[model samples]
Target: MIKHNVISVVLGGGKGSRLYPLTHQRSKPAVPIAGKYRLVDIPISNCLNSGYNRIFVLTQYNSASLNSHIKNTYNFSVFSKGFVEILAAEQTNEGERWYQGTADAVRHLQRYLQHHDYEHLLILSGDQLYQIDFQEMIEAHIETGAEISVATIPVNAKDATSFGILKSDEAGNITSFIEKPNSSLLPPWESEVNDEMKAVGRVYLASMGIYVFNKSILTQILEESEGVDFGKELLPEAIGRYKIHSYQYPGYWTDIGNIDSFFEANIGLTDDIPQFNLFDRNTIFSRARMLPPSKVSGTTLDNVVIADGCIVAAERIERSVIGIRSRIGVGSVIKTTYMMGSDFYQTLHEIEDARANGFPLVGVGENCYIENAILDKSCCIGDNVRITGGAHLADGDFDTHAIRDGIVVVKKRAILPAGTVIG
Candidate 1:
């Protein structure tokens, strides 16, 4: 039953300055997650799994890698009327400026969206990690006959202040919305609390940045309003004028807005029973690279996720997510770190040249101690290097690396000399 009358749009992300260095070369959506997949894959996979295939990913800053990944990964059969497409920002007679905000990105694409014969527009953020069936949300929207439905999740008071909070009436009709409200401004939970929620503790509703809007309503709001963002402007303005509702989602969802959250989200996957399951048969799709299985020689790994085509001769690896084509030399101890492996393996000649040039081959060198850090794709760490985030340094940006939330972030394709110490 192809009843989902929806066309999905994923906001590829803005400047992505919060996730610096990582976003230095690639867009936020292109940032590798779970060792193998990019952040954008989550929303696109969700749309596909929910039977909503006609999707558009809006991109602006540093989109080459993202565009390439999308092109190589998502190819629907000709017979299937489903296509995953990229809608890069462009200058038109209407405007020449880049995407101002989330809502502005969608509004500027109205020329294309107007032609699509869809009932609803499913808007999502590309940097979030979660799995949801949009069909269920759509059904709820249809049942309530709402002009717009904002997907929400229960968050504790501490985390609630970081998100757009909402209050609903008994019937799930959204009454008020506040964007990143302070502690004093947070409203009490209006809807009934479930037993599970009560047992966990007091929690408030936070907007997940996922929204469903009727096509006509979306068009009308964009046409009438000058607001650039939905949470900060459009949605709040529509609260009284339009029939807005809240769809509560009970699932594991995290907004990887910054380095701390991104690191925690990736490390959380190593849990015994992770909130987000990558092993589910329902696939979280990505660009399928033809590569051999990962090879580990005498390495003792615990609670680790090692992706394909990796050669690990490390002495010990604990609670880490290793990406594809990673080459870890002997005696290295990687602990609670995320090694986003290389884009491509170094050729024998390149390796030899690197060695001759006194640089480690495009991966971790022998006897390196990496802990509480993130090694971006193709990072070359020399032998005896120490990258521990125990110095309690909040943030610092240097030529070869950066410290974000105390975690050392070796920049993409950065080269650290032998015996380099970063603490």
Candidate 2:
């Protein structure tokens, strides 16, 4: 059942420089997660699960992969009015500059949005990892008679400094807002959270970068304000003018903003019960690939999430994620790593030719040891290659890989020659 009178706009973030080489060729939303799904799939899936299927993904930076992923993945029935469309930044009569910020992205796409019939607009960040019942949020908005609703989560003081903090009234109306406030100013910023959050020291309410706005108010704000951002400029200024309500969300949510957070989020899936439950009924939809099941030979695997079409002969793989079409040779020991795997399987003749010319294969080769690392898509790790990432190694960007926050990221399609060693 499609939810009527609502449209969702997913903000595919800017250059994503913080994610570095991972964003070198693809947009942030196109970055793969959970071994099989791209980051964009999370929000799109959430919208679909919530019965809000009419989604517009706004992207400005490298969007080729994101476009392809969305095209192949989402297809509604011909009789249905549901569609997931991509609105890329284009040079039009209005302006040619790329998205200045989150609000600017939406502002640029106003013409497209105005054509659609919607009472409310659901704006979401494409880089966040969580599953939310947006229908519940919409129902809350109607119940409170709010012109704007911001989803907030209780975060501790340390984490509060990194987000836009809010102070809400006893009635749940937002009273004040601050953008990444200073620690010294946090004494009086606590909001009333559930006892569970208070017990864990999460007293401050932080914006989750999720929002719902009335159509008329959203249009009015865009037409009147020159603000380029939501958290920074628009929301702060619109506090008194709009009936903004705070919708407290108690769930597992994380912003995949940088490499360290990205690495930890993927590795955390190996836990007995992950915070972000992928095994639940809220299915995360992605491109359907007709690939064979993973085949392992003599490899002892523990707490690993291995995707389909993998051919693993590793000596042991522990606490890691092996993505689709991964090929691990015999005697390789992969630990605490995310191997993004190959885009396509190499033909038998091509593999033989590469071996004949002493070239590395598409995936991890024999006798290799990799830890605390992320091997991007289609990387060629040669035999006997050793990569150990830790605090001891100085951070640097090299031809084959880059080290950020003690995690070595082997660039996409990079070739690490045989006997290559790094620490």
Q: Distance (Å) between predicted and true CA of 137, model 2?
A: 0.4
Highest-lDDT candidate: 2
What would the per-residue lDDT of candidate 2 be over residues 1-423, giving only the tens digit for each residue? 335589999999999999998999999999999889999999999999999999999998899999999999999999998999999999998998888999999999789987888999999999999989999999999889999999999999988999999999989999999999999999899988889999999999999999999999999998889999999999999999999999999899998999999999999998999999989999999999999999999999999999999999999999999999999999999999999998999999999999999999999999999999999999999999999998988888999899999999999999999999989
Per-model RMSD to reference: 1.4, 1.2
- Clashes per candidate, residues 3 or more apart or on different chains: 0, 0
TM-score for each model: 0.97, 0.98
Off by over 4 Å in 2: 1-4
lDDT (C-alpha) at residue 72 in model 1: 96
Give lDDT per model, in order: 0.91, 0.95
**Regions of candidate 1 where Cα sits further than 4 Å from its true position:** 187-191
How well does candidate 1 score on lDDT at residue 347?
Answer: 89
